[model samples]
Target: MFQRALICTDFTDSMYRLAQFVPSLAGGGFKSLVFFHNVSVESGREIPREDPELLEKPRQRLQALLREVPSNIDVTIDVQMGRASESILRLAKQHQSDVIFLGTPTRTMLEEKLFGSTTARLAEKTGTPLMILRPQLVSTYTTAELELRCNHLFRYLLVPYDGSDGGKTLIKKIHHQVKTNPNSVLERVRLLWVIDENVRRELLGDNPMEQAQQELDKLQSELAALNLVVNTTIVEGSPIEEILKTAEMHDVGAIAACSRSIGGILKWSAPSLTREILRGSWHPVLFFPN
Candidate 1:
């Protein structure tokens, strides 16, 4: 679905592995790729200075991964000096990237609050969809397996839906992608609805399961019109756990979701399923910012 992508790598995140898969990524329909690294300015450098020599090592380190990139795929290795969030945004805009790949290891909520998350900050600032892969998984994958994964990063999606506005927005975006890009790799989608047992019964009404099924049916038909193979499921439990469970049960490239409340004024206060999914999912998360 994505034509241009900006892939960010910190030396530890295993994002540099993507540099070795340019031909494999081309199999997934990418037209252009920018692999970026931001050399963090020293914490207490009163006099900031540009040292071309300082950046060359990381530049060559990333450059080591590329070999026989397909002629159709334009690849650029960008090493710049700045904070990561600012540098990524600038490079993304410069590249006109539709998708940005980030390697984010799962972190505790308290850790996120204390140290802060660049992914969270970037999500709030950019409209470009972010696909986060866990470094834990990326680092362990064999080269052959990673090469196979490169070709299906956007193939099948396991989407958690609960009829909320945010959920609807995600569905709409998915539809837009399929409609606008005839070459979109999104082929199958599983729409999952989980009923939270914590919610008051009165609010859920008498037939929550049946009601959810009906809504999913309508959504399935809507998506099926675009020639996607769509399926739906309903279960009872914690929304986060069940969604993760469902994702593991099926074959999917990513768990696609969106949220308006994740990063703005309501960020700290909002109890967002989107944020929860992003924090917990080991599967790659395709997040469309609101």
Candidate 2:
């Protein structure tokens, strides 16, 4: 669904490889692509004073990479010295990017807390949607696999819904995008509701199973009107476990989710389901900020 995408990479993330498949992404509806890279300054330096030769190396590398892109599609390469997240947001705004793509690596909990992921920080700051890809998985994809990934990135999506405010917002955003973009690759969607078994059994009284099914059915009908193949399922278990399992079983390209804002100090301390999914899932995740 994204026509103009701003892809942020560190080069180590292997996202630079996407330049080779620009034609395939164009086939999937992307008309413009901007590849962005930021070089971090020294810890104690207020401003970057690196050798001009050093800075020029990355710019030259990006130019070499862009040569593989097909001439028909619009492309831009940016190599700058700055904080990654800030530079990415600034470039996205300047370019009016429809979506931002980022590559995240698997991190231990300690590493996540100490290092503070750029993807997490960007998600908190930006209103734009993010397509989070796992670098380890993407870097290993064969040419054929990469082609498929580019051409069918959003062909099918698995949505985790629980009738919450975030869930409703996610549905509304999807509806709006589909209506506005007729050439979107989204052909099918699967809505999954996981009943948290840890909650008090009494809280789920009076046929909770049936009630969940009814909620999903209503959502299905609403999305089906957009000329999409919509399906719904309700499962009882841990929300994370069930959602991941359902995604694996369904063969979806990505998991579409909405992030709930956590304000105050809790924003820094509390764990988020959206972040958890983004960190844990090998599959791509389309995160819409609330």
Candidate 3:
């Protein structure tokens, strides 16, 4: 479970959309939320020291805005000067963060061909799970009696498991989260196992999908004992596609995925899947890296 989560920003409108997700993450018992923004300084560029007011003004406004977020959990804000992804990773290490939150904008293939996404880069560099939130869906915000106002934006959660060690690792974290949150508005969490067509064509000569379903059934039974209302889904298609469809169908708050670090034979990486899901789903994504 993530004890301290860092929300990385470039101090844009999209950053605010991502900030809204902190309440739900914190409501799940995360201890602290750190707001991080990076300012770039070129080698020959004029120094902020020459005209400090140019830098000081935005810094002050960011501090004020962060103060307004209603969270009993600890909140800290940091505005730095450096490369964006590098700065975020440094801060995560300095703070010992377990999760990083990012807001990704809808990008065209041409845009991705040129400028890569920051969230994607961070997801590859660290063990911390990076959560990428979509743009806000609700236009209005109503304050509740106590604590932060409910945005009612995301009420569902989708988790994809392949019956692998990595998948179970993610399930354990989610289980801990569920056990901790007794009052979370999250109504349902769906576990999905996709039978990739390519794998079926290669590995299971006759009935690969059936064998896969049997494994998923056992995994579902194990999850049922947790006593939380969990829904199960089994689909046959691309793994990323199936996961995204399930999330969209449920209007999920976010998708929590477990991924492994680069290893010997299994060079499978999740940054692509993370980017793919962010591109397809308007909901947020929570990534767990092994």
Candidate 4:
């Protein structure tokens, strides 16, 4: 339910790729979009202010491309100069953006290790849900495909649940995501309980499916009481794969998850399922800290 969205670009093919999702957003019933282009010097690099036109080139190109977007959705253009991540985050805060869409560059092994991910970094920094698009992924969806994708973007979303206090906290934040954003297209919630067989003998038992179903049913009842359509799924094998398959089957556009902070003996870090899903999911992810 986002009334306003901030879409950031870097004048790359991926940026235009991210733009394609805008029409998808409008189909999901968003009111307005802010298309932002940021010209940033590399982390340790400096900008030559003397050649102001060098900076202006990115903005000019971005504005020219905006004309290609379907005019049905209200759109505005913003040009800024700064660190890409910092500028995008600042604008989101300044505009009170309901959501932020970003483009992630496809990288090789060396690049990934050295460059990491601006999109992932931003997601960690801001609780704001991010839709990260890669050029190839974006091209797979045509106008028709996007229209179909948009239809149920929020209809069925998957949440990997633990049934812990942290899990409850995650759900509360997800409820906020559903309620706070005016243009959120969500209609249903699917609760998934990842059984840690290493920890729970019950999970390793011959008939753990029944137990998983019962757990899902319990959570379903809780969400249904909130007037949301709820779905339940029980899967075995890797937790992340199960979660991703659930999201794929349901055609979920986003995911809401909680991260357990890394600690002493526990050494809890961002959940592996969360990391795997983000790395592989076509959908955006919203992570809540526990």
All candidates' lDDT scores?
0.89, 0.84, 0.64, 0.65
lDDT of 1 at 202: 98
Q: For residues 29-49, write the lDDT of model 4, one tens digit per residue.
A: 677788887766767767446
Q: Which of 1 and 4 is ahead in lDDT?
A: 1
TM-scores for all predictions: 0.96, 0.93, 0.74, 0.78
Candidate 2 or 4, higher lDDT? 2
Candidate 1: C-alpha lDDT: 0.89
**Candidate 1 residue 153 C-alpha distance from true site, Å:** 1.4
Please write out the lDDT profile of model 3 over residues 1-290, one tens digit for every residue: 35677877665635643344556546655668787777777746654543456556656766665534555778777777767788898999999886787767766555755777776566667777777665453223332411242233224568887776767788887766555655434456688888776663766447666776777677666656656457778788888878877877876667886654423112223345544565666556776665
Model 3 is weakest, by summed lDDT over 10 consecutive residues, at: 262-271
> Which predicted model would earn the best lDDT?
1
List runs of model 4 lying over 4 Å from the truth: 17-24, 47-52, 65-74, 105-112, 150-152, 181-183, 197-215, 262-271, 288-290
Reference-based lDDT, residue 184, model 2? 86
Candidate 2 residue-wise lDDT, 145-212, digit = tens: 99889888888999999888878888998888788887788899999988888879888878888998
